[model samples]
Target: MATATLISTISTNLRQPTATFQPKTPLLFRRRQVVAFESKPWESQEKVLRENAFVCAASRRNSNSSSSITVTDVSVSELDDKLRKVLQFVLWAAEGVYIIWLFLLPYAPGDPVWAISSDTINSLIGLSLNFFFLLPLANSVGIHLLDAPVLHPMSEGLFNFVIGWTFMFAPLLFTDRKRDRYKGSLDVLWGFQMFLTNTFLIPYMAIRLNKPDTKYTPRKDSQLGSVMVNGASVVGVIGGAACLISILWGLFGRSDSDFGSVADRWEFVVSYLGSERLAYAFIWDICLYIVFQPWLIGENLENVEKGKVNIVKYLRFVPVFGLVAYLLCLDVDEEV
Candidate 1:
């Protein structure tokens, strides 16, 4: 009996300890599972935060791109507008200076319009007759259509040289895409230009800068315009050849007369330009023509034949010949 009681007490003690520890172990395990569940939610929350950040960054990039494009477009438009205004101002200013320097200034070389001399008048008549040798060549060949005036070869050559260049501009002016912008009669303007030269042309240059009229109808090409446009190649060759000949003629013409050597003729020309108003004015016209020729041709490169556009585009930077070449390569079939 003593042995059985002792064994039972030992077993009771061991069972009591196991029951107490098992309940506490299960409670600790449950607390650890709660911590694991909480950590899983934190991982999902972190993933959501990263996704939102990516979306916000992408939206910002698109917004910045659109804003930059808008800014670039606005800037280009503003720059173009400013440039046009500046060009208009410069053209008008040139006109003012041209009138003042050539006509109004008494101190300028040669006679003012109000006080032109008879010798100057005689020189003008001779130079005009010498142009294309319309009268002089006829007289020389014994046709005797009109009596040609006699003047220094230098004066004759210079006058015709300028006129030749002026003639080529007819095709350019008529074919200008913006020609309809001018409201005046082109016939009258060009007629005046043939005699008056830049006195009329400068104003036309400035006036052509007027903003396009949306409601205005473009006019049909005039009869003169048609002639010039159709015969552009012939005009180019004739004008270009005339210009080349004029230079040579200035240096060597009137060989039978007492004009002296080329060096001496060159010296006389230098003095004439400094002392004669017409000669001085011609210098101004030539300078202005240099600028205007490239300006006009470069703007109208589209009028050139397709295969010849690159040729004319580069040649526009050249002086008188550049314009001549442009005329020779004009696309006659294209509408002005």
Candidate 2:
């Protein structure tokens, strides 16, 4: 009976549905288990971490390169500044030495003509009278003097003419109009006096040095006509004409027979070099032409207009003809 009952129970179990024997877990949980078995979150995290490390390394390299470049640039800038300062000091020292040599040249050994010639003295007196009295007296009556000759002894005329024109040309090289003062009238006057004496230029230079920071409206800020009509042009024209006339007369005209014949002028120049006054004068003139003029030209270059080429700045380094070239190429309208 027991065996028969057992067989009947098995038959009853086999006849029941298979679903009745399933687990208690939900269908959604089983689907998630299958997905978790296929995908790996930890492996994906490891891959992302590796990519991040690589990016950080590249960024570090770029930063290091930029830092190195910055350091190199700073070093180069510092070196350039030092070199510029050294050059400026050398120039100043050279100018000082030249001035000292001029002062001492008069005291050098050997007999030198220190006293002014009687002929020069007489010429000066005549010049003073003509400028102070005759010219003014003639102008009051609407009668203009064609020319007033001040320099005596054709050699003196040549000296004054050369020096005066140099002075007139100098202010044009100044970058700052205010530093030049009075529309460069003072510079013109000082330059004009350079023909008579270099002593005047010393004071002018002293004043300029002491007030190097003086400020004024830049030429670029004002109307072009303002600068053009400020009398500088008129003065320049007159002074240029006078200088040309004096140069011609000194080279060829026979005004003073006392200085010897025109052919002997070269000999007179040689002898004049031996004189203390003329030696000092000549030295000062050289200093102005070589040292000061070039310096001023460099300053003027700082104010050049954008996109404009200033060839005169480089040309100013050439002797004699350089200044002439600069004047010819000067564009007043383009100056700062």
Candidate 3:
């Protein structure tokens, strides 16, 4: 009976479906098995950490580059400001001294401002007549409109030469980018400058150096400015021709005037500067022009045509002819 019972149990076990059977296990062991089958989190976390480190390094580099650029810009601005201040101070000082020494001081090599000499007046009249001299040249050719005063050609030539060169500066001043920095009318200033020369120009130079303000609006150009800017080439030609003619006239002009040889004319010029206040003041104007010509030209080089900029830049240091060349080479189409 027991053997028959055993056989029945085995048959019962074999008859059940194989899918119905399951083995029991400890809970801890089952938890460990499930954990083992999952994907690794540490590798992914490491990749994410590396990516973040790279981003931070790149940001730091960019910040460093920006900081360096900012420092460079600040330094350049400071240097320019310092230079502007120095130039303004020097120009103002020059103006004060120029007024005192030329106009007020009795110690200078010419007559004082309070006194007037008939000989000086006569010389002034002669120089003025010699400037255009339509009647004088006509008189020289026997078609006299009036009597022409006879004078030393060297003195006349030197005076007109300086004046003619100064005439060209009118256009240059009108077209300057910094012209608006001046509060006064350019027309009056330039007009006076023709007679007084540096007395007006030096003040304008110093005034223009003032820092531009937000309240300032650019003024429309005056009729004089328009004429000068438009006729710059004509002005250049006239001024340049005048200068050339002045030199030639000094050396060989007025053949009938009994002026001595070139050596004698040169001697007269040397003595004339020492003896006449007007002539002595002209010497001061010439020196100032030499310094100012390059300064104004260098600043306005952008107004020159592209092809001629390099040439104008180098020639600017030259005195009278340099200004002539610039006016001739101006880009007239450019707005002043």
RMSD of each: 14.3, 17.0, 15.5
Model 1 TM: 0.79
CA lDDT, candidate 2, residue 312: 65
Query: Compared with the true structure, what per-residue lDDT tens digits does model 2 show for residues 48-93?
Result: 5564565566666678677877887899988977876666565466
lDDT of 3 by residue, 54-115 (tens): 55566666785778778888999999999999999999999999999998888788787777
Segments of candidate 2 deviating more than 4 angstroms: 1-66, 104-154, 173-243, 255-259, 298-321, 324-329
Query: Would you estimate the TM-scores of all the predictions?
Result: 0.79, 0.50, 0.77
Q: How close to the true structure is residue 90 of candidate 3, measured as C-alpha lDDT?
A: 96
Query: How many pairs of residues in model 3 come into backbone collision?
Result: 0
Rank by lDDT, descending? 3, 1, 2
| Candidate whose TM-score is highest | 1
List the global CA lDDT of all models. 0.84, 0.51, 0.84
Q: For model 1, what is the C-alpha lDDT against the true structure?
A: 0.84
What is the C-alpha local distance difference test score of candidate 3?
0.84
For residue 38, model 1's alpha carbon misses the true position, in angstroms, by 24
Cα miss at 102, model 1 (Å)?
0.5
The local lDDT score (0 to 100) that residue 295 gets in candidate 1 is 89
Model 3 misplaced regions, further than 4 Å: 1-72, 141-143
